[model samples]
Every structure is written in C-alpha cells, then in structure tokens.
Target: MPSLVPHLAAVIFVSALAACGEPSSQAAKAGPPPRPVLVKTVAYADRVTERSLVGTIRPRVETDLGFRVAGKVARRLVGVGDVVRGGQQLASLDEVDLGLQTEQAEAEARAAAASLRQAEADLVRTESLTSKGYSASASLDRQQAVTEEARGRLLRAERAMTLARNARSYAVLTADADGVVTATSIEPGQVVTAGQAAIRLARTNEKEAVVSIPESLLSLAKGRAAMTLWSNPGTRYEAKLREFAPSADPATRTYLARFSIPAADETVQIGMTATVTIAVPDRERVARLPLSALFNQGTGPAVWTVGTEGRPTLKPVDVAAYEAVEVLIGSGVEDGDRVVALGVSKLDPGQIVRVIEALQF
Candidate 1:
C-alpha cells in the first residue's frame, strides 16, 4: 500500500506539469474577437416624373330621383343597386289626393265653360233685341259685362286644369337618364316632400373620381388629366377636369376636383379608394426616397446618405412634400445617389455598416 501511494503521487505531479507546459488556462479559454460588419455601395435607380395623390371613386353625374309633388310614397318601383333607363319609373307618390284635386279642377273648368256659352247666347239675344229697338242701352251694357266676366272665369279655369295635369304627372318619379340606383331614402308608406331625394342615381357612361387636391399643389394640377391607378395593378384610368371648386375648404384648405371618366369597369364600385396622379409642369425635379432615410438634423430637416465609401453621412435637406411612405427631396440629394433608407438615425459618420435590400415594407 505504501509503494502504490508513491507511484500515484508521481503520476499526479507529471500530469500537472504537462498541462502547464501546454498553455495557460486563461490563454486557452479566449478565442478570436468577432469581425467587423461589411458595407457595400449601390447605384440608385432613376426617379420617374410621375406625381400621385389620393382620390375617391364617384359617379360622373349623380341625379337625385324625387317627386315633383308632395305626397306619401305609395310604391317604390326600384331599390338600391337597380339599373334604370331613361323615362323608367322609379317610384310613385300617393295619387288619391292629387286625383281628387284634378277632378275638382276639371269640374270647375267645365262649369265655367258652360257658363261662358250661356252668357254668349244671352249677349247675342240682347244684341238682336237692341238692333230691333226692343232692349235698352243700359241693359245691353249690363249683358256685355256679364259676358266679359264669364270669359275671364273660363280663362282662369283653363289655367287651373293645366296646373292640375302638371301636378298629376309629377306623382310618377322617372329617371332622366340611364343610371344605377346608388341610394334609396324612402320606402313604401313614407311621405316625401316635393324635390326630396328619394333615390340617388348615377349615370353609367359618365363615371368619375373625385379628389381633394392640396391648395399648395393646385397650380401644378392645372391643365393636367387626373389619373387613377386601380387597386389592382395594370388597370389604369384617366379623366379630364370636369369641375373644381372655386373656393378652398376652410378646414383643410384643399380644393375639390372632379375628373370625368369616360368608361369604367363593371367591377368598379362607388366609394372605393382610388389613387390619383396629376402632372405638374415647370416644377423642380424631386428625388423621392423612403421615409426611413430622413434623419433629424438637430432642429431642421435632414437625411443620411451613403457616402462614396459606404459610410453614413448626415446631410440637411429641404423637403417639398411628405407622401404616403416616401419623401420628396427638394434639395440636398441627387436623383442617382444612394441614401440610407433605414437605420439611418442609428448610424454615425465614418462608421461602416451592412445594407441589405428590404423585402418587406
């Protein structure tokens, strides 16, 4: 047992020396430090001359369908989404009261006509009697006055008959043009006043997109066709300036612009969001960049550009406009120069970085 202890001791001593001879424990624990991230230069794409805006899909011409005479809505011949043609009946007002009034007027007119004929006959008899020296001049004058009164009454009755006929015709609501019913405000048994909107019909041929243009850009939008880029790409539509509000909105200071679309797709429905673009002439060239590229320059506007050495360099910029997710660079950036689209605020001058193409917005 004593001999075995000596041999174990020698073995332990040798192992410790061998481990020390190989390397220090601290030295072996450490590994190489991480390598610096790489950055690359990219040539920017040329910016296009297209301008854009936000707009709404609307009918080119919307006609309100209403009754000319006030009455209870007896029958609604058409409802919302129904297509109607010119002269098509859309609704009817209760004609009972109108019919009664018309009948009364007709009766009055007939009575007046009868009275006029009787007066004329009496006048002729009196004239014959006066010529034969059987009637006095004063009696003849009285007969003439009666005839004039009857003629005046007849004329008034004729006018009343004409008015009654017009009122009756107004009970039937008809479409002035071919269109689809966009809204229905009245139902059966509901009373509507004259000229009240019962239905809103939109003309099928004349479709339009209404856009509120910023007053600042109104000068640029003049003489330009407002275009619509449909939600589905590859579908494009355009319209001329149909109308524009002469006054600016008090709240937003924007002008209302209506553009007429000659033909619209069947799938195009009202109230859908449409992107509008109007060209502006004689405007300065703008370099559009992702909003992320904008950086804070202390207090004023600023941006970060990827310098020739692929390093972030802060630059002060004047912005013409800030749109959806992009910034229109009025100054401080060239069209074909690359700018740090994102992570610009986190970068510093002379610091290297790694830029990758963004796949998602």
Candidate 2:
C-alpha cells in the first residue's frame, strides 16, 4: 500500500505538468482571431451610371472690348473684375493729338467761312457795277464763279471738322454692354491698336458651364446635366445642353460642350471650378460595391468576397465603371455574395472573418 501511494503521487505530479501545458498547446492551435470587417451583400440592379467631369463656369456671351481708334492708352478707368454698364468709359487715350486735329479743322472751317463771306461781298459789288454799266458782264460772271467755289470750300471744311470731332471722341473707349470685366490686356500708358482686345467683358444675364467630353462618352452628354461648384459643394445647379462643338479639338480629340445653367445663383462666378455630372441610362443589372472593397494586385481588379461559411476568398471582377464612392462590377460576382466593404487590403484569401456590420447599396 505504501509503494502504491508513491507511484500514485508521481502520476499526479506528471498529470499536473500536462495540465499546465494544455492551455499553451490549445492557444497555439487556435491561431489568430477572426478579422472583423464590414461587409455588404452583392446585388444586381438597373443602376443609372453617372459620370463626373471638371469644367469651368463661364458666361454665354463673352466679348473682347477694344478701342475704336489707335492711340497710346493714357488712363484705364475700369479694371479686371469690375462691373460696368453700357456706355461706361473704360479707358482713354492721350487726347493731345486728337485735340490738335480738332482745332486745326475748326480753324480751317472758320477761314473758309470768312473767304466765302468776302467772295459774296465782291460778287454783290460786281453785280451792282455791271447793272450801273461800270463793269463788264464777263467780270460779274467770273465773280459769281469765285463765290460758288468759296461756298464749296466752306462745305468741305465743315465736313472735315465733323470728322475731326468724331475722331476725338473715339479716343475714349467705352463699354458696349452691361457686363463684368474678366480680363484686361492693356494697362495705362500702353499703346493699343484699333480693335485690339483690351478688355474681356462677360455678360452677366446668362451663364453656362463648359467642359470637354471624350469621344467614347459624347453620346451620353446630350441630356440635362447637373453642376456643383467646387467653392460651394452643397448647392447644385441644373444645366441643360446649350451647344456643343460640331468637331472635336484637333489636338485633344475631345468635343467641347456648353451647358446652360437655368438657376445659377450669385455664388456662381465666372471662372469658378465646377463639376458636371451626366447620368447615362443603364438597362442592364450590375452589382455595385463601395470603392474600398476593390483590390488590384497587378493582375487585374478583384475583391475579397465572403463565402457562406464566413470565409473570405479573393475573386476577380470585371469593373464597368468607377464612381466617387462605389464601383460597378459587370461580372464574376453573383447576387447574394457577401463582399468586404472596408479594409480589403488587410484581408487574406480564405481567411475567416466576422462581419461587424452588413451594409446595403
């Protein structure tokens, strides 16, 4: 009985050691905990595909203003970004030369008038002499011709004076319409030629967004579009197709499109950056996933799809289009398939995962 007790004690000691090691063995066999992830069940729908393009807000009627006559610019009354009204004086040239020309014309007109008066008096005196038989008829006729020549000279001088006055007025450049000045090409003291673009005026009554569309998607840009300003993102403006260039740009091979904004507010300024969203009618049903779920390992695009047993497997997908927040998958994933919506890069193939949240859409 005493020997049996010693053997039993040794057996109990060994059993205690084994029990102490059992926890470590179990932990080693268990490996890592299941990765918690957010997932969404893939579903196909008739999704309306939308494409966004960056564009510039511009006026429908933008005009380049210039001086009517050539002269050195003496002063610029309006500057860039200045609001101007019709007939507002925008700039002026040095009027010294113009004034001199006007004065010369006026003097010539006065000289011609005085000469005509003198000739008329002479003709009257000659006719009186001829009537009294003191002058010959030929002398009176010659005097009459002189008076007519003087009258013609006076008329020409008056017309020259009018032209000089008009030229003087042309030295001052004025706005032709009500608009905002967007650009100024000439400064004070700079010389400008006739019809040279000195200022760019954008009419404020109407506005539009201008963007370039690629040939592949030109057909989709026909209908109404939506515009959101980069400065004010919350406000969205509706735009309709106003005009599009008939031919593509030779260098870019892209078509220029202009969309009229029916409800443009004061916040929408010229030259502001905007985004145009064009929605294309899509009839086919396609699966959509959040952009975070997409994974590209150099071979092609893929996503980590969760199986029915809560295991994640890498599946290659054909992406039709990519949006700001989501991706449209054309094929390789069926409806009801669970896809990792977030943290896809951290997931491994065939790894078990616990879905912390299931997302829709």
TM per candidate: 0.63, 0.59
Please name the candidate that would achieve the greatest lDDT relative to the true structure. 2
How far off is residue 242 in model 1, in Å? 2.7
* Cα deviation of 74, candidate 2, in Å: 2.2
Cα distance off (Å), candidate 2, residue 150 = 3.7
lDDT of 2: 0.90
Which portions of model 2 miss their true places by more than 4 Å?
1-49, 118-148, 280-361
Q: What lDDT tens digits, residue by residue, belong to model 1 across residues 130-245?
A: 99999999899999999999999999999998999899989999999998899999999998888898999998866787888886777645756645556664677766788999
Residues forming the 10-long window of minimal summed lDDT in candidate 1: 34-43
Reference-based lDDT, residue 11, model 2: 97
Per-residue CA lDDT of model 2 for 1-361, tens digit only, reads 8779989999999999999999999999998899899988888998686789999999999999887778899998888889999999998999898899999999999999999999999999999999999999999999999999999999999999999999899998888888899999998889888899998999988999999999998876765589999999999899898999999999999999999999998899889999999987677778878998899989999998887788889999999888778899999899888888989999887688898656454
